[model samples]
Target: MDLSAVTAALELKSYNKVADILDNLMLQVAADGVAFHNDWPYAIHLLSHFYVHDINSARFLWKTIPSSIKESKPEITAVWKIGQQLWLRNYGGVHEAIRGYEWSQELQGFISAFSELYTKEVFQLLVSAYSTISIEDAALFLGMSKDDATSYVLQQCWTVDSSSGMLTVKKQPVVTEQKLDPRKLQQLTEYVFHLEH
Candidate 1:
């Protein structure tokens, strides 16, 4: 699978463009359309699942998953199980395995921010892509071009400090740097909150 596209989108966190690609891919396989599964909780669940160390955050995400969907999408259940297992991996301490070994509030905050900024449909498209994709294909996906769309995604995932690991985000648009305003920040905040609940 071509991951370049995925990676490129990741850098930018351009969900709409990413969603469009995922829509095309899902059509190929007949998987329950990614768009159908998109919602705030899924974003919260997935972002926290991938980036946060806390089990409860993931658990919260799982709980948010619709029972009907879980019943229908066994693959999703399977993937969630794998994610749970990884989250439970023994971070061996002197006494025993510590479940909280990977805990990071920073990670949690990041996810929370995403949840607020993006909607459920926005996230579903992403979740569908990640589960279905392989690194090779991800690169292939990135190789395709949508110039404006690609730029929008890449710019959001950028930062100078390596301390904050770069991941895709629902990027904010700015017509010009000088034009950025509080309203734009508020809009992004809204998108981030959409996933938090």
Candidate 2:
């Protein structure tokens, strides 16, 4: 998949929105006639990501994920089978499958059991911190325009007041006189760049 547009969409902080975009991308891949098998691994990886990261309905994917490829599967079973075939074809199946390409056996076992539950709870902590600090707001401790600050906030870089120091989205106390150092600025730039195109 060309992630350029999806990378830009990651700027949206709403995990629900990300899931929608992910589902749409999956649909696009299914619609395309070519290379379904090649793309299936990425599709499985994305499902794992959604199940591991997003708080909302993260458990839903786990429920839907087939354990040992049972019978009475959804049509989407084809997706997983294609992914498994591709995996085996490239790396060989089961115990012989390349350990590097596969999830750590322990981690995969844990995920197969409870990754959905774990991520939903973990995201609670992530959003809790986000409630207090935005990546955008962190950048402007030295001071930047409201528009720029808001862009960073929306991009999940910082959560500062849309009004610069005067106000924040949640009316929290503004951070006091601290200038961002070159090191912090570079890190923030890289973080936002990763989320954006």
What tens-digit string does per-residue lDDT give for candidate 2 at 1-197? 66444445444323234456656666787688544433333334333444344423433543544554334433234334423433343212211222223454323542333333432343333445545654333333313344654564455433455444432334335579988799999999999999997
Model 2 residue 112 CA deviation in Å: 20
How do all models score by TM-score? 0.26, 0.25
lDDT of model 2, residue 26: 60
lDDT of 1 by residue, 15-122 (tens): 324434433443553464335443322432344343333456457657766788778744446435535544654112210211223324423444334333432333
Best by lDDT: 2
| Each model's lDDT | 0.41, 0.42
Worst 10 residues of 2 by lDDT: 91-100
Worst 10 residues of 1 by lDDT: 90-99
